[model samples]
Target: MSALVEVSELRTWFDARQGGKRCVVKAVDGVSFAIHRGETLGLVGESGCGKSTAGRTLMRFHNPNGGRILFDGNDITSGDIKPYRSRMQMVFQDPYSSLDPRLAIRDIVAEPLNIQQPKLPAAERDAVVVENMRLVGMNSEALSRFPHEFSGGQRQRISIARALTTNADFLILDEPVSALDVSIQAQIINMLMDIQERSGITYLFIAHDLSVVRHISQRVLVMYLGRGMESAGTDELYAHPLHPYTQALLSAVPTPDPKISRKKQRIVLEGDVPSPINPPSGCVFRTRCRYAESRCADSVPEMRDAGGGHFVACHRYE
Candidate 1:
């Protein structure tokens, strides 16, 4: 199957001034991946690892500093995103902040239609809003309510409803469940999966929750300090993670089976993540990697395929 979205050597940077000097923070640097039509690709990393930035960049919410973005085989790197807005949508991380407090639920859900189809009749727009709300497990009865009346989970459902109002084929779900309760997270994840099955929508699921990623993603890409560390089929990556950073992350996920938990060895990484503005040369993870060698500091390790489509960026594999 062809990729629905392809990003090559993507980079998104931010300019800042520190100590009276200009500096560039490489929020996302040299990352590449593809999301097949109707498939979910999980992007996982620690906080500040640029997963969110990558998602925003893909949506053209942030202009890329370098590289290319292709949507359904058309280059959309530096063009007006208005044309693609309806086809691509995003569910932001914070449900509380994402929704407009001033708007009623009906208006919030119909806002996209108003923008994309300005001439759409009010009755038709309201029908679309109710339909989308039903798709996200919402009722039309809540249409007149304000955002403040809903709980975090309901607010998130509203966000999802709003994203689907335009019938987007691809969704950038930036930690959509991270802010909700553990039980609510499962509900939201299941709803998303159900929606995908019904609509054949593709998703770029970004989150730090390894277990959740493993549950929903067909493939997983691990990131650290704006660079990709490893990527492989979800089962393959979890079963045999090659990169030290990947290993450490997997180790931190708690297991339900006491026997397995007792037998598992956790890999603790030392030192904090290096500043993106002054990221170390060569391997960005070398500073905290236990298996780091002198040569690891010489240059960034090229992503190498170990076997069966599993790829890791670590000199040790070479």
Candidate 2:
């Protein structure tokens, strides 16, 4: 299947003044990946690893400092994004803040339609809103209520409903379940998966939850300090992680089976994550990597295929 979205050497940096010195923070530095038409590509990493920045840049919510973003074979890195807005929608992480407090549920769900199809008749638009709300397991009764009347999960459902109003084929889900309760998270995940099965929608599921990613994604990409460390099929990467960072991350995931948990050896990484503004030389992960060698600091390792399309960027693999 052809890719619906392809990102090449994508970079998104920020300028800041620190102690009277202007510095640049490479939030998403030379990251690259592709999402096939109807699959979820999980982007996992620690907090402040530029996972959110990468998602926003893909949506053009943040202008990338460099690199290319192609949607359905068309370059969408720069230019008026209005034409692609309806085709590419985002479900942000925070449900409470994402919804407008002042707007009723009907208006909130219909906002995308209003922007994309301003001339659409009110009755027809209302029908579309009601349809999408129903798709997300909501009813017309909630339309008159404000955002404050709903719970976090309900608000997220509303957000999903709003995104679907555009009939979006691709969704950039930025931690859509992190803020919800555990039971609610499962419900939301199942709902999202069901939505995908029905609509054939593609997703870039960004989250730090390895377990959640394992459940929803067919492939997983591990990132560190604004760079991709590894990318492979979910089962392959989970069963046999190559990069040190990837190994450490998977080792930390809690296992429900006491027998397996006892047999598992956790790989605890040392030291705090380095600052993005002043990252380490060469490989960004070298500072905290247990297998770091002198060569790791001398030059960056290029992503190489180990076998079966499993790719890793580490000197050990080279």
Candidate 3:
């Protein structure tokens, strides 16, 4: 299938004021990737590793500092973004804050329609809203209720309904299940997959949870300190991670079997992530990497293909 979204050298920096000094926090720096039609590409990273920023940038919410955002093979790097808004949508991390508390579910879901297709008759728009609610497994009675009336998972479903109401082809799912209970998380995940299978919607699943991403994504991209560390087909990445960081990350995942669990060597990374304003020279992962050498500190390693669509960025790999 053809790419639905292609992001090349995407960068999003924030001008942060700290102690009267202005510094740029390179949230997403020089990232590049593509999401094919009807495919789920998982984005995994640490809390501050810019996974969320990358997702937001794709939606043009961050106003990218540099790079190209190609949607459906069209260069949308410079445009009003209004026309493309309907084609792409974001399911934010927090469903609680994502929806308006004062608005009923019907109004919440219909808001996107009002903005994208303002000329739709009230009855037609209401019909669409009710249909979308049902798509997310919500009932008509609940549509008249507010956000606070629902559980975390139900709220997320409502959020999904709102996003899908636009009939978007590409959806950015940012930690969509992180805040929910384990059972609820599974429900939401299954629901999301159901939607994709039915609508052929492409997804960029952003989260720090490796197991969840591994389960849902066809391909996975691992980020560290706002840079791409590794990317590969999901199965390949979990089986043989080329990048040291990727290996360490995978090692941290809990094994199901008791025999293997005790034998698995957990890679304990040392030191906290450096400030984004002044990231380490050369490989950003070098600071916490146990295998760092003089060569690693000399120059930034270029991301290169290891094998079979597995790309790694580390001097050791080179």
Candidate 4:
């Protein structure tokens, strides 16, 4: 199938005021990727690597400084996002902070429908909310309670219910299970998989955890300093990571078997991640990479087709 969402060289920058110096922080600088219909595209990176920012930009939460965002064959990089809000939804990382304490569970879940389709009857909207709640494994009685009354997992379920109420085909799941318990995380992940099976929703799953990304993603995109490092099939990327940053990342995912874990060669990268403001020349990840050379510093590497449909952005890979 063709891409449902196509983003080309998307850039979202922010001005930072540090002491007396003013500088532009490239939160999402020249990033590009696509999300096909009915597929989960995992975007993995370290904290403050602009993974979340990319997701928000795609959802039009932030006005991109440059490039285009095409959704469903139309350019939606500018103008009012209200028309597409219902078709695209975002479930935030923190369930506690995302939901409003003032509103009851039922009201919170039905908010999208109420905003987008205000003319709908009260009973009909309530039914739609309840059905969405059911899809996320939520109890009907809990709808009367506030967000604070439920557990972290339950609150997240309510959040998911709210996103689903609009029948959004594209969902940006930004670390949706990061805040929940391990067992609860599995439950939510399974629920998401079930939702995909039933509704064929396209997902841009962003997370720092490689293991979680591996579980639900068919394709994975690795990011560093707001730029895409590599993107390939989940198994392909994990088995043969082309970028050094990706190799270092995959090395950290813990293995279940004692023997395999013991024998595993962890690629411990050195140095702190460079700031987005005044990032290293040529390549952002070059400072910490072991394979950095004069060529790596001289010019930025473009994404190259590295056999078997895998794409990598590294001089060494090129």
Mind giving the per-residue lDDT tens digits that candidate 4 earns over 1-318? Answer: 999999999999999887789989999988889889999999999988999999999889899999999999889999988889999999998999999999999899999899999999999999999899999998889889999999999999999999999999999999999998889999999999999999999999999968888989999999999899999999999889889999899889998888988988999977667899989999889899988999888899998899887999999876
Error of 2 at 144 (Å): 0.6
All candidates: TM-score = 0.98, 0.98, 0.97, 0.98
lDDT agreement with native, every candidate: 0.93, 0.93, 0.90, 0.92
Give the CA lDDT, 0 to 100, for residue 126 in model 3: 90
- Which pairs in model 3 have colliding backbones? none
Ordered from best to worst lDDT, the candidate numbers read: 2, 1, 4, 3
lDDT (Cα, 0-100) at 58 in candidate 4: 87
lDDT of 3: 0.90
**Model 1 poorest 10 in a row by lDDT:** 266-275
Please give, for residues 159-198, the per-residue lDDT of candidate 2 as tens digits. Answer: 9999999899999999999999989999999999999999
How many backbone collisions does model 3 have?
A: 0
How big is the positional error of residue 192 in model 3, measured in Å on the Cα after superposition? 0.7
In candidate 3, stretches whose alpha carbon ends up further than 4 angstroms from where it belongs are none
Q: What is the lDDT of residue 250 in candidate 2?
A: 87
Candidate 2 Cα lDDT to native: 0.93
- The sequence of per-residue lDDT tens digits that candidate 1 reaches over residues 165-229 is 98899999999999989999999999999999999999999998588788889999999999999
Q: Model 3, poorest ten-residue lDDT window?
A: 266-275
